[model samples]
Target: MSLRYKSAEESRVVISELMLPSHSNFSGKIHGGYVLSLLDQIAFACASKHSRAYCVTASVDTVDFLNPIEVGELVTMRASINYVGRTSMVVGIRVEAENIQTGIVKHCNSSYFTMVARDDEGKGIEVDGLLLENTTEIKRFLKAVKRIEMKRKRREEFDREDFVPEDYLSDLENYKVKVTCTDEL
Candidate 1:
């Protein structure tokens, strides 16, 4: 079959219910981390659609929470492939939570993620060179490109630091990657 979505087109995934609670925080808003996990899942869907290959989240850039999501809101996650490299693909995912009952829509978060599509041997695979379909898609791609550039710059700035982040310093336990040999294939 042909590819799922055009390069310059917006591929959206809607989440009807993501466990919204009536009252959680003092402000009665859903937790930020909960929303972040949902974004990761939707971004995975976008990457898988583009490459038709299993992918893993390599890195998640800055996530700016512009607004809050109340209970009983329908969180619609719109994601699209923005940039492609040798083995890594960057997807732009915008998550908006709307109150279906009150018809209120608000932007929750906008973030970019890097995904690596791998073959059965757990190696990166080659993805098609997709073409943009319109100006809006092109605009999104450009914005993601800029964000990636900034990521590189920020990495360089932190290169000289000896302190390692807590997550990085933690032991790599239970993070085994499944790999299969060609002979077994």
Candidate 2:
């Protein structure tokens, strides 16, 4: 079978919603969970559009809330395929909030979601590769590749059979926790 390639622009998704009081937390700011839900929705849409198959979120790599979103601001989220594997794609999402009256926009959060396409039988299916058009798209794809590699290395190193907790004790010296298992050690 021939390998299929899709451009990043073909799978891009953008959504805007007005933040309401219902979406706010006790402190009156828009809740982080609400923002995360929007991010997931856009990620799924972008991944599904790229693969033309049902996609499921396998992992969320990073969700850094850089700025607080106000209830009255309009929140816009943009998602596009950053990288694609045989059966999975990494969707990068950027969230920004705009004050309608002031015409000012603030970047609120950025996240990366790993989504895997599945067939009707619920089996993983191969997805189309990304066709990077510009330097920015190329850089995003490379960054996703590096993130995946680093995550794999971290898991392998931490889950090794010969892992020793004591060896990492000194690394936590500046942390707030106090180790109290001296007798057990």
* Number of the top-ranking candidate, with TM-score as the measure: 2
Output the number of the lDDT-best candidate: 2
Candidate 2 structure quality by residue, lDDT tens digits, 1-185: 89989999999999999999999999999999989888999999999999999999999999999999999999999999999999999999999999999999999999999999999999999999889999999999999999999999999989997788788899889999888876445
After superposition on all C-alphas, the RMSD of every candidate to the true structure, in Å, is 11.7, 1.3
Q: How big is the positional error of residue 99 in model 1, measured in Å on the Cα after superposition?
A: 1.8
Off by over 4 Å in 1: 1-12, 22-27, 157-185
How many clashes in candidate 1?
1
What TM-score does structure 1 among the candidates reach?
0.74
lDDT of 2: 0.95
What tens digits encode model 1's per-residue C-alpha lDDT throughout 100-134? 87787888888888888999999998765557777
Per-candidate TM-scores read 0.74, 0.96
Alpha-carbon deviation at 150 in model 1, angstroms: 2.4
